[model samples]
Target: GLRVLDNLPAPSLPCEQDRLRDFMGRRERGELLIQKINKLQEKLLKKMQLSVSKDGFVHFGDTVMLLNPDSKSSVKNCPGACVRLTLAINLDEISIYSFKSLEAPCGVSAVESVDPVARNTFCILSVDGAPASEPIRFGQKFSLGTTGGASDRMLYLASDHKSFIRFAKKSHLQQVFLTDELSYLTCWQAAFLDPQLRLEHEGFPVP
Candidate 1:
């Protein structure tokens, strides 16, 4: 004899739905956290004006000048007699600008210069027109490859006309080879490159 048996429904755990909801909530929170972190990183970078170069150089704009220790001055006053101890070093010793407050050019995309045969050094300057000026000097001569190649003919420039002419004569190159590319470069790029070279020469991190 077969007895009729009713199938019982499977038991449902009440906590399962709560667990799913909790997991979804956590996932949403995680996404929001990631977005916040990204926004914070971007804000910090913009505030610092930090940029990295292809050659692994790090750059910050004119703000570096404000941090220069040499720019600080002390004032001494003694009963109506005041003396200002201007300990600021000449800008030339630290930067590449021919004059104070002079910056690089605006609206330029790229600038590069090379001096080959001695140490094989090359410099490339990029700018978006910031009000900062510094000169980049290579400690070593850069390679220009072959004589007939386009890279072999590099345009050289000095801070002044006399230096330009002197360099031209010393290199036995035509004066036409020298140009005023500096006029087209922005101040920030020049300053960044200037300090970069100095730091590189000192064996310091470029950033």
Candidate 2:
């Protein structure tokens, strides 16, 4: 009886082994959860970049192409035909850089048909919609810098209550003041090369 008892394994050995196994399993699960959380955080950060500002303005400052209402057809046929417009916004002021046309030779440094025009600070104004007024009339307007302060440019950004669809139709702007409609066109259905790039109020791209 004594010899049999000596040959038997310790009674606490199996319990200790089970406890060690459980600890390892918990550690692995915890590491996996942490990895998943980190990935989720990264995605959220990317989305927060373009979130609406505290002032209820959805600001945009990136290399945006001004395409026609029929932008899909034009872009598909000839991407170079799209006019590129660069915007510089400093929360307090907005500047516009525009060229007549895009010219690319041998894929080298592209040239502009006309000298790039740099506009001074633009004034934004929001107009309330009348019962019969079109949605475009109710949105914000970026007053173009004119010699006599004529306020011609009316690139309507999306309003708080309106979807961006109204801005897509050219008919909406039939009565809207547009000295150069083609220059400030922003087609809603157009495809941007890298729309993810956003600008901060400090006039720099968000990393």
Candidate 3:
């Protein structure tokens, strides 16, 4: 992490431009969450209080990380599981980090996308290969980042809802999801948090 911080502009940002904006913005506000990061760079990148990862993770000089809110020492272990930190657009005070399941989910109803990438429409279902029971909405007022990017769409869902998909963008079997490594973490974060849509096996490569 210090090495990358020393390298600044060249530090690999695996995420899209939007995610970086939030980090840089918060640095301006002098938020404490970011202060912890700055303190890590006080000495040479090799001073090594904390180490930065190219993949979507941060670590202290050692491997075993222990965080205790009651102790100031815990700040070193802070940012747990969160890769790139950002403020929710609507919830300005909240921070979001991408987290991926260590293991894939099991026994959950499947979700698949019916919308083809060539077209902007995205229809989805949990069934093995059945047509949706309801009509598909051609477009929506909001977007995760890209208009037709499925992952971005899913990230939007994760951040915006209390009961994400309490009423899915559609009706039918669905629910829950969760995020990524350093450079790849943002998009991967969107992919995992995207509520675990189980596209048909045949469409394994669904957009």
lDDT string for model 1 (70-175, tens) is 2223222334323322111122222232111212211111112111211112233324332223322333211111111122333222222344434334334432
TM-scores, all candidates, are 0.19, 0.19, 0.14
Candidate 2, residue 24: lDDT: 85
Model 3, 1-207: lDDT tens per residue?
Answer: 454456447645566676778778878876545474443222112211222244342211211111212444444576443322221111111232211111111111122322222111212322223232322222211121211122232221122133544533323334322221112212111121244443322222222
Q: Residue 5 of model 3: what lDDT? A: 53
> In model 2, what are the clashing residue pairs, if there are any?
none
Backbone collisions counted per model: 14, 0, 12
How high is the CA lDDT of each candidate model?
0.29, 0.29, 0.26
Q: In candidate 2, which residue ranges exceed 4 Å CA deviation?
A: 1-74, 86-121, 126-207
Q: Lowest summed-lDDT stretch of 10 residues in model 2?
A: 100-109
Q: Give the lDDT of residue 44 in candidate 2.
A: 19
